[model samples]
Target chain A: MKKWKRSARLVDMTQQLLREPHRLIPLSDFAERYQAAKSSISEDLAIVHEVFQQEGSGFVETVSGAAGGVRYIPRAGWERSRETALRLCRELENPSRILPGGYLFLSDLLGDVSLVREIGLIWASFFHDREVDAVVTVETKGIPLAYATASYLGVPVVIIRRDSRITEGSVVTINTVSGSSKRLGSLSLSRRSLQEGARVLVIDDFMKAGGTVRGMIDLMSEFRAEVVGVGVMAETLTEERLVEESASLATVTDIDVKQNRIAVQLGSLFR
Target chain B: MKKWKRSARLVDMTQQLLREPHRLIPLSDFAERYQAAKSSISEDLAIVHEVFQQEGSGFVETVSGAAGGVRYIPRAGWERSRETALRLCRELENPSRILPGGYLFLSDLLGDVSLVREIGLIWASFFHDREVDAVVTVETKGIPLAYATASYLGVPVVIIRRDSRITEGSVVTINTVSGSSKRLGSLSLSRRSLQEGARVLVIDDFMKAGGTVRGMIDLMSEFRAEVVGVGVMAETLTEERLVEESASLATVTDIDVKQNRIAVQLGSLFR
Candidate 1:
């Protein structure tokens, strides 16, 4: 084994930690890999830790125990997250985005990799302390955001399909209503997508009156899974909220279809 | 400004590169951030570059000129990719995964973040030289894989919905057949999801005779977009493949319903 310098160790350690988020990597393993002392490895981690905190990239959590070591927790600072939400609000406020029935044409943002990742990092920060066994979301628009967040959290994503397919084996289907259109819809999930008694974090691209979010929460009960937290990239702001206790990066204050105007406000995160 | 040591600089650089893949990052930016000389930053990048290459993590390319800078290309080495595929093959060989009509129950692997990301990195490496403006995939299972690949490639994802919705505005719908079951199916893509003359890379979770892949390619033509390449996680072994010049990680050779056996083989990457 080669005795790596501090510079080389820092570079390798950062990559390792980022690749395996929420995983506890022992200092002894790093020491052995680089042929450095545990104390020296700790020093290298400290420098990486400081830069992560200062830059609002994430956190380096150190645990002192026989089986414990250092773990990387993906998160962004409060101000950084707020700025990300604000920038999104500006783009979503486009007049052309107003569609029928108060819906916004922001499909582009749901597919945007960088924007989804920014929201994912921010969402991860909020649930860094909670034990999230898996990330769950409905299919189509929300899959990208769910995958992005799951990647940062180093967890699997369970997508709720709109229709059941024979290829999915046995599935649990639930009937729910679309919040925006007030029409009934169905969501199905394969039995194997999640484990029994799993702690799930529900993520969706949009929350229009929270009907879809409520559907997801209700569906989790069928698997005996608990919905620990719910996060959405953007949600509608109104008095008639279907489900409460949710976080969003941006809020759709109003959408005037005939006037072709849409107002997007920074979400509850700013408050 | 406080000058950063070699260890601190390495950590910051790794994080910055990881955050913005395929984007050019000048050494001067790093030098200014750490208040270090350009020469020192170059030396640090060289060390980071060597580690990334050796570990099969990614690539660090350096260009020389007024606008030249280092760009990180997300990829995994051939050996690593092959190993990932082989491991997946072994697990997929389970007889229980066999479904009716030759379909395998692989929704689980499609949702696994680590697995999807590992395959996504490999797929991105295959088309890194191509001018990919966006990733295209059909709705449901392929969404996660498309998003993962798009994240690494730094491109947006355009999901083709099974059914058209008014919320998506004007959409282009195409009729296709299920490759295995020979049943008619419809796929629709929003007119605004992709721009005309754009180059697209198509990704999917499973492929059988490539009917769905063919549908996506035909739909892309409706948008005047070119399909640069196609990559699937697993493909069925049939001499009558509808689309050629594609890549896959694993191949299902045989699935015996009565015998309760499945034969999984390494895909084109091995060949």
Candidate 2:
């Protein structure tokens, strides 16, 4: 193949490989399909894999054994991750993010880029070693941080939609209460979204009463999936609903939105 | 340096480069800091750049001029992107996402993995060439979709808080009438969060009257940032007043909650 066509084919192959990541493809298959030598196909895969890793968008794992091939792992890189779940406890020392009636201003920080990046990077850094296949989160706010973590980890993100639809093909639905609005809401996951035995990292923008976390825990249980870890952008020390298995970037002690005065204790996230 | 340490250092350097992607860096500087040869540093950077591009996260540009170095350009890759976007438009045609007052039932799709992935990929494809630095959206539902697109493009996401906070450091506030509620509400962006001249991709879950999008547009202008593109999970085509340069995956014609029926039209994106 000529150079430009070869380059175009490389783009097509990269796209196809990314479409079905983590799935095995034999070198012989590529050689026959593209009418190219196995060595040339290998070179093309290397170029695509190198570009992806450099961007921190995904990972390429090549198996050298008899039945081995390249597998794409979508990763949420460090800069985009919320890595310091413990440090969040320190940031929670601040009187702010704590609102009257146990509400938290965490939605504010979750909306912040630098703060969420630090938090996401810290959380992803810890999960880098675990065989986490995907990151999951409830609808609305958690989606942002979840997407960030998923990108860094090079894994696809699965969001549990609050409403059901026929177009999803088939789904498992559950009723649960969210901590933020203190309202009962339904969560649904498509039957095909997650594979059984897949290790999942649960993340959220904030945890007040932990009701939503419990709901997610229940949701994951329905799929028979293991929850490897849980990370939050910020958590309230006031309620201990969530266990040590979960981590947070910032912690909130108090918030008096009525008085418009808030206090935040510095966390050890940057350190 | 040893292999593991060298990999860790490369990861650190990649993170640092991502933080200031617009700035170019010389291989000599990285080599000197790491006490490595220029050739080794170049090899490391090649790996980094490859990873970034393959994942559709970002890019590394080699400047051959007198004052040139490697620069990272955040861009999205087109693996399953067009297919995903087209699928989302088909799914949006489902009547389920429709709600009363011409509202669309997008909250569910925003939470779905396949749906979110397709939506994100589509949005990223549109802004891939615009050099979007951040994704912006209003509070609540829009956060998830915004995060997804931002993740694919490897850009930081800045969320506009519905409520203001002192801990946000300092914020620039704006007021606009939302098409949904039609009530005047205030949206705020932290001064430090957004940079001037940065191209932003605006994403939202649904658009009813275009009030919130207008508010977001006003908020972006307040920061002197550019609106590279706008995307929505669903749009109420019956409602006038769309934010001029916006796009939507699905269009809602009607929502009859009482009759248990919704009317929808698909494929309004890229228009």
Candidate 3:
């Protein structure tokens, strides 16, 4: 292997660390890859860590021991998180998002990959130290957010399906009722999707009375998985809240279909 | 702002470039952020570009002019792509994945975030130059893959629902028949999800007779969106094929339910 310059090593190291957040890379691996001394690699890591800390992007955590390695822990700074939450509130406040039956058209916002990633970063930052084994969510709208958060946290995503499909093989199905509309629904998870006793972080695009989230928590019990934390991109203000504790980035305070108006505010995360 | 050291600047620049792939950043922006001269930034970018090119990860593309800037275009090396495809084939060949009805259980593999990201990188490398405006996929299993590919391409994801929901507002629905099973289904896309005449790349987790992909392409027509490309994580071998051109990472050539065996091979992407 050719010797790598310090500048080239720094760029490559930063790229690798950012690419696989929460993954540990041994110092020997870097030393071998760059054909450089361990001392040199340490110096390079310090520079990278300093830059990340200053930018509030994330930090490189070092584990000193035979089985220890360095891992990147991604974080959204308080200012950045607040900015994202405010931006989400503004986006949710658009009158054009108002739909029939008081439902907001959120596909556009959910479809925005950049925004989804930003929100995922915020959730990951909040739950980074929770030792989350997997990020879970119900299928369709929440899959992107779940995947994004899982990516940042270096965990797999276990999706609960609305209807059990043949492709999922054997699944555990549970009946659910919407808290706001009282609509009956079924949530299913593949038997093989999650391991028993694994810690999971729940993520969703929206929460109305927290019915779906509550159902997810109930289903997680079947797998013997622990719900380390729960997060939603946005939650509506409702009189009936099924889930007792959860975090949200934005709140829909009021939506009047007749008046074509919607009121939005920062979620509990900011508060 | 404090003046950034060259090493710190390089690390920060690499992180920003990797975080926002395909987003062009003006040299002046970096100059202002780092309190450094454009000449220094240019020198740093050259080093970043060289490392990326040599590693086959990607290159920093420079658009020289008043309106032109630099952007990171991520690319998976051919060797890496082949390795990922082969690994996927091996994973698919597990006998335990064989379901009673010959449907292979893939939820576990699809739930793996790192593997999904690797596959996404390969797809992005293949379609990065096609100028994909949005990634489109039918709801359920494909949502994660669509989001992953869209994230790599720096584009939004437009999900095509199996059944139009009230939350989608007004949707364009198209009836489709499963080319293999001869089952009828409806594919719906939100009218607001995509723009007229937008270039789209279709992504899915699996393709069997290509019915879903075909339906997605037809639905794109209603939005006047051009189907720039189509990709699937896996495809099944069948006598009847509906789609003419598509890429897959792995192909299940045969499935024996009685014997609980599955024969998997590299998809067209490797060939």
Candidate 4:
């Protein structure tokens, strides 16, 4: 292998770290890849680390000891997260997003890779210290967010399904009702998806009365797992709250379907 | 904006490009962000681009017109993709993964963030140049792959659910058959999910008889969309292939439930 210059090394290291976020890479690995001294690799990492912090990109932590190495933790400052959240709110406040029912048209938002990714990084910034073993979400809308968060956390995503299939082996299913609508629904998870006593961070695209969130929490209990945190992209400002301990990036305080008008606010992440 | 050095600028630029793949970025934006000359930004981009290609990460497109800048397109070389596919097959070949009905347990692979992201990149590399408007997939198991590919393509993902809901307004549903089992199923897509005449790329986790992929192809036609391409993570080796215009990463040529053995080969991607 040819010795890599600092510029090329910086770019390559950044790609590798970003590709596998939250993974520890020993300095020796970089030294071997670049055919450079450990000291030089360390200097390159410092430059990358400083720029990452200044840009509110993420965190780079160095671990000492025989099994020690450096890892990239996806992070965004509270201020930057709040700004992203507010911008998300503004983008969603358009009247055209108001559907026939009280629900908002957010598939586009959930489909926005950049927005979903930023939300993931911001949520990761808040929960990186929680020691989460996995990120969880129900099937459908929440899958993308869960995957994004898991990518940043370097963990797997356990999806709760509406219906259990034979391909996943035996599953644990729970019946619950929507906290606001009283609509009965069931969520299922494969038995092998998470280990017992695993600390899980629950995520979703939207929370209304937090019924689905509550269902996932209830389902996790069946596996003897601990819920470390709950993150949602948007939560409605409803008085009837089923899940209390949760965070959201944006909130819809008012949605007038009759008039095709909607109001959005950045969630408690800003506060 | 602060004037960033080549080292710091390279790190930041790589992050920005990787954050949103397949989206064209204007060079002026980078110049403004770093408060540096366009020439300097180009130099930084060249380093980033070279590293990306050398690392088999993705494509760094430089558009020359005034509206042109540079963008990243996630790509994996055939050798790397085949290796990934073979690894995926080995992971699935476990005897314990054999379900009661001979269906392979694959949710674990789908849940794996690194694996799923790599498969997404591999598939994106094949379909990115097709000018796809969006990546489409059926509900349930296919959502993750759809989202991953959509992320790399910088396009939205359109999920076709088994049942229609009021939340997404009016939807178009179609009844289809499982090409292998001959079971009837219905899939629905939101009217707003895709625009007319969209060139869509369809993706899925597994294709037994390509029934679900066929359903998505039918659904796309409802929107007057063209099926630009189809990609599956794995396809069963069968004498009869319902969908011919498709690509797969891996193939299961044999499965022995009685003896608890299975065989998986790198799909035709190598050929």
Candidate 5:
């Protein structure tokens, strides 16, 4: 095998580490690939780690001993997380987003891939130490955010369907009622979607009194899975809350259809 | 600003380029960030580009002019694409995946983030040159694949709902009938989700006779959006095909639920 120059190796190594976040790659494997010594590889990793720390993007964690290797854990620093929350607040303040029934038009924001990815990074960083086995969310609006967070955390995303389909095989279904509107609904998850006793992080686009999220938590129990964390892109200020604890990126203080006004603030993630 | 060593600069630059796949970044911006000269930045880019090309991961295109900059275009090499498809085929062949009425249990596969991402990369590389303004997919199963492809292409995703929700505001809906089963359905897209005359790439998880994809193409016309391309993770062999042009990663030739047997082949993408 041909040896690689330090410059080329550094570029390739960064790409590999970033591509598979949270996956440990043995140093010997890298040493073999680059035809370089293990010490040289360690030096290269130190440089990458320092740059990542300086940039606040993420850090490369090193493990020692025979089964040791390095893994990239993605993170959004305090400055970046605050900036994202402020931007989301500004976007939510748009009067045109108020609908006929005071519902905010969020399809545009959810569809913005870059913005969704940024929000996902924040959640992944917030829950990085939870040892989450998977990211879970209900269908429709929450799918993108769930997938984004899962991608960054290097985990699979299991979506809960509003109505179970034939293609899902067997599923665990649960009943739910909207906390704010008192509407009835059901959430379903395929039996094979998650393993028993797996640790999961629940993610959603919007939360109002946490009815849907509460339902998700109940359903997770049916499979014997543990709920490690719950995060939402945005939440409304409601007097009655079903979920005891959760994190959100932005808060909707008020929405007035007749006045065409909406009030927004940074969410609990910043706090 | 302090000057950055070449090794550190290469690692950071790679991370930035890979994070935003198609966004062009000016050389001057790199120079300013690294406290280096434009010529040195150019040299660094060349090194990154060479490693990417050698690995068959992607290439960096440098646009030279007053407004010109460099952009990274991600691609999946033939060997890697083939490997992904074969692995998918093997996973699909398991008899446990067969459900009643011959419907395969695909929820597990769809929930696998790494597998879904690889499929997305294959589709993104296949349709990278189409100038896709957005990725469009129906709700539920297709959302993950659509989001993954959009993330790689650096484009937003517009989801077509089975039933229009009030939260969507004004929507354009169309009726659809399953080509294989002849089941009646409807597809809806938010009026503000897509712009008029925008180019879109359609992605889906499964296609038996392309009814869902066909409906999406028709619905895109309602907004005067052009369907630049259509791609699916898997498509079953059928005599009556509704779509004229499409790409797929894997093909199911036959399925015998009673006998618990499924015949699979490489999809049209390889051909």
Candidate 6:
């Protein structure tokens, strides 16, 4: 049997096992189907489990007793992952998305967790291969998506509030030029919220000029944390110097509010 | 064996199965442990699966093979159901929850899905013994909770937007007063969103004057949709007009914006 064919079969088997977890399969079954030895099948299962877990999806537990086989107890499923990113791209493409006073229309996207979950999965997928310790997003709108992504990654989400809240405890404050309107705004993170040397994944609902992203970068610098990657549900592609490396679920290229029609370009997502 | 003892054992086994979804067990093992016949075990399993599914909590899928056993998938565990209502009460208990205009500060609860999911589940539990075809909420805050509740019941969520959007196609508009402000607000729903004779679960993030709930009732009357129940994350308990029958996660007794504190009482939610 060809090596690529074996890998393809492995992928197929992995997906099947994921959908229906905890069922034990006899070794003879796979040996007959793949024309592989019991040892070979076991090796393939190990690889499949590793890839899935590394992707932050979940675990494939193997039971070794006579009744035991391999099962995928997914903490998160591929259905949730792929759908989340695709929906973000779709909503970001909307044209009325452009707001006066340099605000962006994200209430629709933030309101939809199905959309946020997919976007979170896509972002997590990008960093699935990368090492990241935590996710950060500004409070209010971005909290839902950030929380969704962190939940998928099995990490805690830290919100950067616009103002100090009694619940958040003490905080560190930073001032940065607004990427959208180019005005000054204060950004905040609770003290003890982030740990030192942690690789932080920054996420938000929208990025106009990347000012908020830049503010997060500054905050990370203040905490001595590492910026692993940046992700946004929607971004104005026209902006510059805001993000060194980033992913946008959708790109808003044109907005004609007078016509109440928005033009959007759907980018690569959810595949 | 006594009937009550057997029922208690069934509940325990049901919970255990729900906690571990992928692990299959043979009926003979359970039958031997309980000193009961296979027929009795089968009957118990049927009732267990039925109640679990009806609660919208999780499920039990049975395998018919000789070696096969029942598996529990803790998809949405009971802890999630209880914690949600508890958390909402905690947030609502804050004195700062009171607004000067007799409004309750429910924006925080509306944006959180975990909390919303719990609130939705509590609502679903009440309607579990009842029937609901859809969930209705006025845009934009109520939409998220409505979606969460609808997801729990496996029903559709119909949004009554303050302003009609062309994307939703033709809509039926009705003018009604908001509860807190006692000010009039328009509720509009797409004509295709709901069907006549459908029973609806009305959900909102906060309630003050009971006007929005009344407005929703009026809108339901227009479509001949039955108001199966009205639920709010928080409410001003002082309101006189009860809006017929309703449930609230939390109740606001007073607000001292001067002290930046709000006082609220927990309502009988899941009860």
Top candidate (DockQ): 3
Error of 5 at B193 (Å): 0.6
- Evaluating just chain A, the predictions reach TM-scores of 0.96, 0.62, 0.98, 0.97, 0.98, 0.68
RMSD of 2: 7.5
Q: For model 5, which pairs clash?
A: none
lDDT of 2 by residue, A1-271 (tens): 3333344345446555654544677777767767888788777777666656765656667778788777666554555343344444445544554444545444445655545555555566667778778889876567767766665565677777767644344679999875545678788887777899889999987676787788888889999999998887766655547444676655555566666555544332333
Model 6's CAPRI class? Answer: incorrect
Error of 1 at A193 (Å): 1.9
Indicate the fraction of true inter-chain contacts that candidate 1 also forms: 0.81
Better of 1 and 6 by TM-score: 1
| lDDT by residue (tens digit), candidate 1, A197-250 | 999999998887888888889899999999998998888876778888898888
Q: After superposing candidate 1, which stretches have Cα over 4 Å from the reference?
A: none
Instruction: Estimate TM-scores for all models.
Output: 0.97, 0.61, 0.99, 0.97, 0.99, 0.52
Q: Where in model 4 is the C-alpha error above 4 Å?
A: none
Candidate 3 residue lDDT tens string, A210-262: 88999999999999999999999999988889998899999999998888899
For model 3, give the TM-score of chain B. Answer: 0.98
Candidate 2 lDDT for residue A260: 56
Over the stretch B167-204, how does candidate 5's per-residue lDDT look in tens digits?
Answer: 99989999999999999999998898999999999999
Candidate that beats the other on DockQ, 4 or 6, i.e. the better one: 4
Q: CA lDDT of each candidate?
A: 0.86, 0.66, 0.91, 0.87, 0.92, 0.64
lDDT of candidate 4 over B1-271, digit per residue (tens):
5677888889999999998887789998888888999988888888888888888887688989988989997888777887788889889778888888899888888999999988888878888779988888887788788888888888888887888977777889999999988999999988988899999999888898888888888888899999999998888877766887888888888889999998888776665
Q: Give per-residue CA lDDT, model 1, range B72-142, as digits (tens).
A: 88888889988999989987998879877766888788878888878888888888889899999988888
In model 4, state the lDDT of residue A162: 89
DockQ of each: 0.78, 0.15, 0.88, 0.80, 0.86, 0.05
Model 4 clash pairs are none
Stronger candidate by TM-score (5 vs 6): 5
User: What residue runs in model 3 are displaced by over 4 Å at the alpha carbon?
Assistant: none
Q: Model 5: which docking level applies?
A: high
Q: Which of the two, 4 or 5, has more DockQ?
A: 5
